[model samples]
Target: MSQAKDQEMSMPSSRQESDRTAAPSNTKSLTLNSTRSGVGTGNFGGYGMTNGAEKPSVLHMIMEALGLRNQAQNREPTSKDIGTLIMLGVMFLLFVISVTGFFVMWFTEYYNNTMLENLILAENSDTAKSWLNPDPKYDTLLKAHIFDYPNIDDYLAGRADKIKVVDIGPLTYQEHTVKDEVSFNKNFTVSFRDRKSYKFLPEKSSIGEDYVVRVPNVPLISAAGPVKRMKPLERLFVSPWIKQFQEPLFKELTVSEYLWGYEDKIIKLKSLGRGRRRFGLLMSRNGTSVDSVQLNTGEDDITKFSIITQFNGMPQLDYWEGDECNRIDGSEPSMFSPHLLQDRSTVNVFLQVLCRKVPLHFEKESSLQKSSEPVLLSEHGTVLAQRSDQRHQVLRGCAHFSLVPALLHWRSGAVQRL
Candidate 1:
């Protein structure tokens, strides 16, 4: 019985060993067949092909399906690594687009605000043209107009006699009214000088005039009508910001015909020769009284002078002397000796006048009422003849002088007037 039992145990042990060995062999065969099939069909997952190792976990299976793991060998991608790579690619693409858009927007805004607007204005209107030009006629006219009074001899000598006239057509209508308002404050420096010698007056000479004109803050208005008649308030509506400088940096001098008299009586003729000249005249009102006085004359001197001119304020002639018995020839305008009027207030105006001849000196002493001492009123220069009343008046006239149109025509290569 012992022998039989021992035999049975031995048989059982052999069978167990055979089973283990056969299991391994079968697994290897299956793996080989699966790999071959997978290679041919490119379907490793479907064929249940695995390397000779433990089967992959859920994580490993997912990696293998996504091509991150090798089917021939057990391999898998980490969850953290895969997620980070996908995020990096998406962020990089977004960054590239964002950076490109920023530069485009910046350049677009710059061009629109500066270059584009100026180009449009220049193409459409002559008024938008630049101040600098090469033509001599235009150059002279522009300088004269802008600077108030240009030396006619100097300008004429530089160019031909002919003059050109420019035609400024009707004003254009605007679609919208300006709503923005601008405010500014500025201080100007005014120096006094002698009208005759063109010399600056001493600070203690009581010849200088200091004026502060305050322009209010306002909105811009349309410039559709005659610019001369346009109100400052309306102008503010069209251009909210006030231009600190409208005229030239240097003072402009302009001259005009001057008519002399108090109210109604005709007086003796006075010729305004080149430089300053003085004339003695005698006059009587209705034969009631005779008065004798010396008159300081200029090119634009007229017989019947009106003391109360309504341009700015009514400026009264402070002094006038006339002689009664002097029967001067009306046909031949009488001329007097030239003398220098030092530190004259209206010298700038005299310098700017457009006339055949300008006065260089005068015997009469013309001055402003207020004196700061050493700085005489005439020391700064003369006021422009056209703008003389304007300085004291509240009305703000259009600075666009008639000279501008003429200048533009000259600059446009047109023939001279004369």
Candidate 2:
């Protein structure tokens, strides 16, 4: 009985030891599972609570700490975009400047042209003829003074007495013609004057014989004194506009020829009884052409001779003046009219006639006082008449010639006249 009771006690102790060991293992496993579950819950709460007032997720916190959120939200500009903006601003500014410059230039040119035109118009308006001849003192023509030489006998007697004597008899006269043609590249001025005079006829005259002879340079020498004294006229007439561009405007005149008529007879004396008998005889044809282009008269060919004279003069041509006056429309002088005469020497005679297109402001009139309003004389807007209306009778039946080359060029856009 005692042995059996001890065996039972041993078995119970072994069972109790086993149960204790199992309990520790199970408890450790339970603790590990609870810790893992708590970690998982914390992770889920962090991610889901981003929009709420909770701690940020790991990704959000990392981005915020590095300033990546701000970097992404406000991007830095690229070099291309920055360059494009600068270029656009510069281009816009340049466009504005260019537009402004063009307008400034256009206006400046327009203003200058307008001012020049006005000045030309004003000049034309000031020289009306009615204003120039108000006083009668300006109307009278000036007469030439005459001088006489010693007779042939007195001169011969003086020479025989050892006194120096010059023969003034048997004077022969000759005539010549001068034709001058002028051209201008720009506006120019010209002025000229000429005359023809005659002396008394001898006792006997033959048909077709000139009662008066022609003389060359006689009047020029008598009027101008000497060649040295006449040099100014030569220079003024030859190249009147050489240095004219320096001036704002210029004027000039040219005389193509002058005519005169004198006796064609030569006196002869024969020594008889200490006294001489004087006789006059005809030499050449009596009616010879003077400084004029001769023309035939219809029925009066015996006693009448016709002559044609041409006189051209211009003044006050302004170069800077633009083509507002339609001056470039045709090639011709706009203001002055030139007359063509058969004999310039015979003031009362008319053989052939010519007229110039002269501006009316420069004309002299007997009706106008020394001062008057401007005289406007234009047939069309294009045709300008000479200022001297009384001196020049406007021949409505006359022919016209286009002579200005510069005006032709302006109209054609070519340098050469058409």
Candidate 3:
């Protein structure tokens, strides 16, 4: 028992010494682990040499991801890589095709536009032969006429003496012979004071029946300045189809304070008659003492100032609307006559001869003023001598042409202008 007791005591001493040595070994291992953690995997021998080897770069990583880490690596192309290459090639080809198509379309449109412009220019050229007539010589024969004059001054100054006026028969429209009686009469005289000044006097004029009154010649002022002219009447009234849409083929214009010096005759037509009455009245102002300042013909004036006719106590054309040829009924020629069966039915009409610039074309050919720009002239006047008692409500209308010197008649309301 004493020996056992001494052995136990020796064992205790050895265990304490071993415990002390194991503690030191455990502390050293813990320090080494801590140091390795802070210094990174190089110290721990993970994925690289511990001492001085460099880490893998981004290029190596990219190459590894693409399975091309080695140069000249021998491997068959995968299906995914092949598909990517094909898609990129196809995208590039599509882009090229789109660009080429755009250029082709643009060039084609430009070529067509250029061709169309050339064709239009050729069509509008005056020298070009008429498409309908073919040969240009054919048009000259059809256009020959006495009244087809270029200007009013040429027509009035005995230039149209070669073409004697002839009766062309009653103007008829459609199948219906103009069933209404129309009469026109006018007498105009011009006297000159000096070469620059002149006066115009109307001896007698009426709104009904044909009356021949010679326009006296004033040698003093007749050979002088430019006479107001009118443009061609080709596009005066537009097509109904275009008008329905309110589309203007010509530019719209309005002028303030247009001065005129001619007498205006307006008539509201009620009906028409089959036979037209024609006659001639030659009356002259024997002694015409004219004052240039007041523009009055003194008490000796034998000229008729105005001619008025009444139907139902109202002036034939008391109210004047514009002259619209399209407004006239084309279906029935009888519609122009006032003898319609309907009661209280009436048609309005206006007749006037004024000195003004008439539009020659739909487009604005030149600036708006006559003094500043060139213009067209039209011989305009409306006077008729017809007897329409209340029994016959038919009102006849007609117009005649004549010319007077500009300086002779400077009356405020004498010359009408638009």
Candidate 4:
């Protein structure tokens, strides 16, 4: 036992002194060796000279470790070495192919994008054609329901018999809109004057032109507004004309005479810039454009597509005392940006006639049978008109005017943008 113990002690201490230094035989070992060599580039390198000896590349060293290469003079290769060489050659070819494939994919996408950008909004492009002549399928029918007072005699005489009122038949009209003097601006906007002429749809109407309903005297009430604001001398000078007008508090006429045009004694005196002396409810505002609109073309930003950037070269109007009420917001009724609908729940709209701007709150989501996408139904609740018993509400202390309630529907799916 003692002899065995002596032999173990004199065995050259295999734990420390007898331990042999190892040479790299794989990628991991080679990487570690290169890191310790201090001449390697980055974390795993073979780029610089160390101790006056050139270091081979990671690929070369790997081949040597695999017994497929010789650093010194070449020897007759074995079958195993030939197999390894073939494998290494295949790996190198695969690497080259991978790099080439990635580069080709990137280049193809870039080229396609460039082509798409150049083709956008060209004179012959689909976008320009659609803008010039909108699709008939997208046209929305505009119909109105006029509220009539059946017991105006009792209501005016302070008789509160529930203030009986009824809604008349649907008045159907076709909009023939024309956008003229279109100018493509350099600032990625298009300026154009918009006007809309109406075509009465007698066939679609439930009530004919001869149908009459008793309602408030629109012209007399309109004249009374100016009379209240006039000075005493101005009122006195206008008193004779007012007496000659002979327009009573209420007047009876057919639907055609009220809506189209009717001769009036006072119309000629008030129309300084008007072409016709006759007056109608809808005739004066039809196809009338006193301003231009600047719309974004979505050339640079897709979110601003078809949005009204400016109206009459101004972002807001001076017609109202409320800042929020006068500010112009939202896109055209036909077109809106797909990106904008992602996170928004409420939609804003610019109304030309009644209220300038209003919020359309979301009500519910529904799917149409013809469309694959779901749409959100929104509406402007009668928060203004419902507050008082008066038929008309003052516009931010500006003037007394009535508003027609309307609803808006928008699709949730990604709409194709220009």
Candidate 5:
């Protein structure tokens, strides 16, 4: 009986050993198949079975309930999610646009307010053209005529032999309207040696009509019409006589070189006679009156007085020809003279002659100079001409005179009519 019981237990042990050996073979086969079929190399729980490695979580339950509990899964965005994303992109674009518009408006306002002042307060705003009122007839044309016959010759001959004169001092400016144009005139007095005096009056002419520019606090309207008539001698004449001859027969004094000397002297003109000489005095025009200096001597001879007038004249012909100083720069040295007090602003007068210059060609330019460098020409008003006082004794002959252009031109032929 004991032998029969031992055989039964031994049979049960042999069956359990066979089962453990077969279980490993089946697990190996399943794992190989799962890898080929794109399944994860993890234990998938059977129906109502549990896995040792995995635990049941909320995400798994939710995915399982939604029928998406797969190792390889896909999810598409819903219409609601797409709409929300589009709304965010549109808001970002609108924010950029609003910022850009804000800066544009600020810049426009700043330009119109501040930049407008520069144009309105400018000293000169002469624009030669206007889009609003454009007329080809109003344009100035400088034409070169053939200078053939009676036309130009007659015009020059018949023109008045006079110069434009202005007397500048304490002036009274008057504004008036003339022929739909805004015009201005200044009135002043003229006295000859304090003997005879007359009130010199100028005719009103147009103003403020130079350009078509408009700015804040500035007048919009401008003058538009024919240029004012010129004086007889003021017109620039180029005769055929110039082309026929190699050069002009007689030398003419240009307006710029008209104010020549400090003392009284005659300057031969272009006329046929002894070519008149300018004596006494001449000076650059000061408005209507020629700039003159007066010395009031209290009955003492000016030759004996120590207070002499120091006058500076234009650069001389010798310096212009070729001088060492002239080679340094293109500027010529001015001449100075000290003489007894005279009634005229200039101490002497000079005659103009034709000149030629030989240019100096340098291989290389010198170093640039600063603008504050010293110049040869001195300042105009070094000393003023004042009446003598008790502190200083002066000659009685120191008299100041403001002569008419006619008196200077007729006596000395010193008038430059412009």
Candidate 6:
């Protein structure tokens, strides 16, 4: 009805008054001189009359019943009315643009793929710099605990049935690692050697490094075992040297010497070169790149990112006995694809020190409580793969790996093994 009324109001100027009079009152030809938002200018509601020339019709009756019939009037559009019309048009256009942009992002792979590309390792990129020269502030800490036989004399004198050892330390150290001789290979891989150094944190430790504790004489026991396997003539020659130093079965030593370095006559003789006379479990590891490593940089295939392609230039390890057992394969500590955790798969991590890979099976689904967004994990803001069967070892040329339980966590775009 409104459409027909609008059409009727917009009549051609050639139509005369006689022709307008012949037309129905509802579609009475009239000039439309007003904007849609403003007042109707000519013959509004078809009730305008000059000396009562207009007559009643069905259009008038219907409009009157519907409360649409009104007194005919005309006025120019106000400034406020024009302003409102412009504002509405602008708002509608904005709405369209917003909806279109939202759908484009939702339906396309632009965002996710772009983010993945930014993470790709490029020689001149920030990602490369971060890996090459790692920040010391990263939470790569090593915590160690030592056991001490407090009643060593009593046990040695056969006063006690078995040696009762007490847990002595929780020595904490921040491990700082740097990738030296970093080279981005042409085969979508990167090769580097890691130089690691440790800083002791007294505040995080329960006891000082100077604290004295009694522990087993590892050098004496180690020498005695091999000497016992030798023939009587051979044992005689080895026994003399073992007796020259004559270290006790259990000896007292400061925590620092036992952990970092301790002078040992037997160890010094074994070195054969002009090596340091001091010997400790982790002595040689400090500030040293023991082995070279090669890894996939996720340039071609994301699934292979951070994977250990080679160690010391060999794809598989010669250190182990069997081929399957000796395979040098597993991802790095801080590099894993999120999709790899979708079905809760077992993640394998390569521990360079262990010279093998440890499997981290999925246990549960959990999340991290944070202000920005919760990060999904295994349990209790931690991602530990609990197992009734975790520890295992494979014999390889008298070398075995005591694979301990490992934990993993995720950050913005990286993964970490603990």
The number of the candidate with the highest TM-score is: 6
Ten residues in a row with the worst lDDT in model 1?
A: 188-197
Q: Each prediction's Cα lDDT score? A: 0.30, 0.31, 0.30, 0.63, 0.29, 0.68
Evaluation by lDDT, superior candidate among 2 and 4 = 4
> For residues 1-418, what per-residue lDDT tens digits would candidate 5 score against the true structure?
8999999979989999999999999999998897655454444543232344546555455455555455344344456545655576699899999999999899987875453332221122221112112243332221111111112222235563432332222222231111111111121111111111122122321212121211111000100000114343432242232233333111223211222222212122223246433322123121122211111111233222211121111222233323421221121111112231122232222111112112222122234367544332222431222233421322222122221211122334423332
- Give the winner by lDDT: 1 or 6: 6
In model 3, where is the ten-residue run with the lowest total lDDT?
251-260
Best by lDDT: 6
lDDT per residue for candidate 1 within 1-418, as digits (tens), equals 9999999889989999999989999998888886676863345455365445354577666566667667666445667747855676699889988888888888888965454333221222331233111122221110101111223333346664443332221111111111111111121111111111011223322222121111111111112223337688866653332233232222211111110112211111112234223211111111111111112212122221111121112122211121211112111111121111223322211111121112232335434445523222232123235354433332223121112222222345434332
Candidate 2 lDDT score at position 246: 30
Q: Per model, how many backbone clashes are there?
A: 72, 40, 35, 0, 21, 1
For model 4, name the residue pairs that clash. Answer: none
- Model 5 worst lDDT window (10 residues): 217-226
Q: Show where candidate 2 strays beyond 4 Å.
A: 1-77, 123-418
What would the per-residue lDDT of candidate 2 be over residues 26-74, giving only the tens digit for each residue? 9988878855665523434424322334564454444545454443343
Using Cα atoms with residue i matched to residue i, what is each candidate's TM-score against the true structure? 0.18, 0.19, 0.18, 0.59, 0.19, 0.65
Model 1 CA deviation exceeding 4 Å by range = 1-76, 106-120, 123-418
Question: Is candidate 4 or 6 superior in TM-score?
Answer: 6
- lDDT tens per residue, model 3, 123-164: 233311232123422221111011111222433464542323
Residue 41 C-alpha lDDT in model 1: 38
| Candidate 5, lDDT over the whole model | 0.29
lDDT of 5 at 81: 46
